[model samples]
Target: MPTVLVIEDEPGMAAYLKTELQFEDYSVLLAYDGLEGLQVYEDNAQVDVILLDWMLPKMDGLGVLRRIRQTDDVPIIMMTARDYVSDKVAGLDYGADDYITKPFKMEELLARIRVVLRRGHERATYQVNDIQLDTKAHSAVKNGTFIQLSQREYTLLLTLIKNVNQVVSRDELLDQVWGTDYTGGTNILDVYIRHLREKIDDDDSDVIQTVRGIGYTMRTAGNDN
Candidate 1:
């Protein structure tokens, strides 16, 4: 059964939603506020989907959504009382897979959940260089040995793996792994690259290659192609 995380602040709303999802045979996790939601998310990194409420205490749903997107593309459905087109567009721009307005039918909500889960499965199956990122398990391995990673490290590695053998610029890495709001400077990317090299490239010495001045490339060393 897929695990679904419900980040709804209202007790009644959260409980009802959880009941419905549980009836559908999904394992559920709940967070009453966005800050706690984030903590739960980081801990339950393997959650298959998130049902988020727009207005949340501690941190808003959008903030939490933005933070989660910086590290993983776990499927998300933003649940909100706000129904404006701008609200929906903003949620999508921030990486929400779908948006559902308040007072929605259980059937409609379930339909949207199925749709996002389908797409999430496609991403979960993607792999490169014998290294498979098990999105459902929230972990990765190369030739079967676990490749340990920090949250940011996993994001960076995933980005490189997704575009394997291509030159991915520092700006793109910063935007994708750290999000657009990151103000940490280019040196942070360099730091992450060094750390990743130590882990993924430790034995081979050629997994991730620096393109110098541009960014980096993920490929075997000494292969011109």
Candidate 2:
């Protein structure tokens, strides 16, 4: 069974989430404050995902997020009463995989958790044509040649290859690669695309293609079918 760490402070809300999640067959871990949450996460290796609250007694959600991102990439969903766009962006920018506002339906929270877990599994390692990405190793290879990638480059490549043959919109790519709260302009995406092309593409062939004003696509040559 997948384990979920619920770092919510409110007794009622925490109990409610724990009950619902347990009913869905998930093993739930509970912590009432950010400090306790971090300690629990550090001690538990089986935690598959984290449901964190923004407002807490000791440390805030963003602090916990930063600390976790320093060493682990476990998926995290920020569940808070702060519903503003800025708040959501702040959570995402801090490395949260997803964000949910309070007063949300339990069903929606369950769906989001499922989606995050699925994405984490899918990103373990992905391949397209001769290019391969092992997210576990944080490495990429093309045609048997190892290619070193910076963190952002690797994320961009992963996103493109995951959606290979499809025109991934700029916004989608940005959200997946740079997080939804990314303040950088779209040109940053173009720059990273160029960096990836240089590292992965050969003289006679290009795997990454710009779709005019739409976005970008990764596909094998002559396979436009």
Candidate 3:
């Protein structure tokens, strides 16, 4: 199940968010303070998204954002009563994917979350080399043959497929696929790419190309090849 991390100092607001997110069939993690929020993220790196508050006790939301940015790039939606344009700009500059104002409608927040997640999953499949990824179905197929993928493999594949012909940087893939909550620093992306190549490209042709000093890109096979 998809998990959400809610970091809000206000008890009532936090509870409301938790309850609402749960209603959406998402596993919700609640943090009463920024410090606790960071701890929850550290303990559970698989969190799909985060709802952060601007102000909090035991470290502020921006600080938490900075710390998380140093490692994980999980999508964050900041909520604040301060409606200043400057505040929104600051949050975006600090790496927040989206921001929400206080007293907002639950439907709006849920809509934003859906858009972000959908975009993330959309990148998991591509049409290059006669392969298509149906993200909603969480499956990939080549020439009508279904490809089975582990959860992480599916996410990583989607990231590459989404950027089919573009050079997707490691950091970008990490932030979007691994999420901002991931703290691991190994060559996990490389492993997944190799796995994908083996299953999707190795026997036929190399669809995923590694641009030296840049990132990976997928190319469709030409008739000559």
Clash list (residue pairs), candidate 2: none
Clashing pairs in 1: none
Residue pairs of candidate 3 with colliding backbone atoms: 72-180, 73-180, 74-179, 74-180, 123-158, 124-158
- RMSD of every candidate to native, in Å, equals 3.8, 9.9, 6.9
Global local distance difference test of model 3: 0.80
Please report how far candidate 2 places residue 124 from its true position, in Å.
7.7
- Give the alpha carbon lDDT tens digit for every residue of 147-195 in model 1: 8888778888888887887999989999887667678778999999999
lDDT of 2 by residue, 1-225 (tens): 999999999999999999999999999999999889977975675689999999998888998898777445789999888789998988888899999988999999999999998988444667888898875456789888889877678778877887888999999888776656569778999999999899998898879999988899999667774
Q: Write the per-residue lDDT of candidate 3 for residues 1-225, one digit (tens) a residue.
A: 789999999999989998998988999999999889977886775788899999999878898898776545678889999999998998999989899999999999999998777666333234666888764455689889998877667667777776666788888878765666679984888888888888888565888888777777777666222
Stretches of candidate 2 above 4 Å error?
Answer: 121-225
Whole-model Cα lDDT of every candidate shown, in order = 0.85, 0.85, 0.80
Better of 1 and 3 by lDDT: 1
After superposition, which runs of candidate 3 have C-alpha atoms over 4 Å from their true positions?
Answer: 121-225
* Candidate 2 whole-model C-alpha lDDT, 0 to 1: 0.85
- lDDT value for candidate 1? 0.85
TM-score of each: 0.71, 0.55, 0.55
- Local error of candidate 2 at 166, Å? 40
Instruction: In angstroms, give how far residue 21 of model 2 lies from its true place.
Output: 0.4
